[model samples]
Target: MGLLDLFIASTIPVLKVLLITALGTFLALDRVDILREDARKHVNNVVFYVFNPALVASKLAETVTYESIVKLWFMPLNILITFIIGSILGWILVQFTRPPPHIRGLIVGCCAAGNLGNMFLIMIPAVCKEKGSPFGAPDVCQSYGLAYVSFSMAIGAIYLWSYVYNIVRASAAGTTIESTRLITGQSSRESSTAELGSCTEPLLPSKEPLASEHRIDQYALPRTKQIEMEDSGNKQLLSKLLGNINWKTVFAPSTTGAIVGFMIGLIPYIRKILIGGDAPLHVIQDTASLLGDGAIPTLTLILGGNLLKGLEGSGMQKSIIVGIMVARYIALPIIGIFIVKVRLGFIPADPLYQFVLLLQFAVPPAMNMGVITQLFGAGETECSVIMLWAYALASISLTLWSTLFMFLI
Candidate 1:
């Protein structure tokens, strides 16, 4: 295909996203008032808890199989590399930009998580349908592309929930603490007092011990006892670390759906029953697919509604936005190309698959970041601002990168 054809193919999907997003923005206008704050929140909840899980489950069940899983193992590694490298870049950007405490996680998340699912779902098939497309015959390309995209979506959900979700959660907690300090001016003192209050026993021991008292001093121990105490302390430290992790977020609805989908896909008996036209249980799959189809358009609309907030001035620094764009669009794509080229020996030789891998690194941040910021009430407006710019530039950046990626492959 010509460079112009590739550019056109790539740009079309982004343009569709933009148009739907614009409609969302319009619906959120004061006069329209259809997708205002409360409405948006309710819609967001449905998308998060319902539409998203259905999409992930249905798509994975349809595409993933034991053989495909083995063949596509490297794609997961590639996705992980994108997140790792993007996170490193985000951290560097955070240090340089020093955004407000609340937005630090938002910035890091926007950098690390790409629109791995939706963008590819749109772009891959569109590219395949292009005349003289480089990947393969359109029918075969479409089938494999869907599988690749579906697998990418499942893996990306895992990383996004476990890694990015917690980062944003931590940032939200820090922002809350910082805000408390600013308001009360005694947050530290109160924390210390709370800690001290937990130890209610008297500093000086009484002559008579209470009925519940063990009458043994914890501090007075033999050398061996001290070693045991140290081991206990280590266990406590490990427990604290584990407790800090948000298991709920780690096994978020989307992640749960992915796991369930994998089970359905990998177990031949289950797959035979659930996935094909001749399956006895195909109705379940059909229903899930119906719900899944709504995920992207709804997400895009929510994205547009959120972007409306940016118009009111989010107080985010221009430099921070620029940094995120540079990391995701400029720095990450270059790094992805290099990574793919270097690992060519291990990577699947299919140019189409290679294109999907490279594209993962090139797309804008996941639309779910807006949902996340809103969920935690941290930097929602600022997230909108960043997304506005990131997506606005995506049209041009994605076109150029898609052209280059195809040309190189």
Candidate 2:
């Protein structure tokens, strides 16, 4: 394919996303009020709990088999490398920017998590359909491309919920702790000041003398006993912390769906019964796919609604936005090209597969990061702002990278 054909192929998908996103933005307007904060929250819940799970499960069950899994073993590793390297870059971005604790997760997440599933789902098929495509016949290319995209989606969901989810959660928790400490410290200082002001004798000392160092030491527990007590307390603290976490959120619906899908896909009996046209239980897969179809559009709309906050002034730093853009677009894609080229020996020789691998590194941050931030009610506005910028720049970046990736493969 010509470079212009590749660029056009890439641009179409981004334009589709932007158009839906624009509609979402319109619906969120005060005049429209269709996707206000409360409405967006409710819709976000549906997407998170329902649409997303259905999509992941159905896609995985339909496309992923044990054989395909074995063939694509290196993909999961490639995706993981993207996350790890992006995360390292994100951490470095955080150190340089020193954003608030709450926004730290959003930043790192934006850097680490690429829109692995959705972007590929849109881009690959579009590329395949192009007249001058390099991935062989359109029908064959799309079939393989979609399967690759589905597997990518399933694996990406697992990582997003497990890794990026926790990063945002921990960052939000840290912010809360910092705020509480600041409040407590301020209150303590206020009480101290008040007490000092009310005191009549400014220079008076206590009648009792302070304890001698030897006396204090004598009252202390034995060293071994103290160590044992400290260990016990630490264990209790760890237990309490563990007990406090919402495991449901950790093993999120999307992750659970991926697991279930894997089980169904890998089990021949289950797959035969539930997945093909001739299956007795094919209705179930069809229904799941029907519901799954809503996931992408709904997610895009919600993303648009959330991004309305950026216009209302999210107070996000320009540098942080630029850093993320640079990391995701410039740094990550370059790193991805190098990694894929180095590991070319282990990967499938299929150019489409190689293209998908490289593309994973080039896509924008996951849209679900906005859903995550909204779920936690931490840095929602800031997330919106970052997503706004990241996706806005995605058009040009994806086009250039897609052209380059195609040329390379």
Q: Evaluate all candidate structures by whole-model CA lDDT and list the values in order.
A: 0.90, 0.89
Residue pairs with backbone overlap in model 1:
none
Please, what are the lDDT tens digits per residue for candidate 1 over residues 1-409?
6887767766777777789889999999999999999898889899999998999999999999887888898999999999999999999999998888888999999999999998888888888887768888999999999999999999999999889999999999998987787888777789889989998898787887665676354545688678888999999999999999999999999999999899999999999999889999999999999999999989998898998888787777889999999999999999999999888489878898899999999999999998898889888899989888888899889989998999899
Residue 311 of model 2 has an lDDT of 73
Clashes of each: 0, 0
Q: Give the TM-score (vs. native) of candidate 1.
A: 0.91
Q: Estimate each model's TM-score.
A: 0.91, 0.88
Over the stretch 134-213, how does candidate 2's per-residue lDDT look in tens digits?
Answer: 89999999988888999999889999998899889989999999899987998899999999899898466656656763
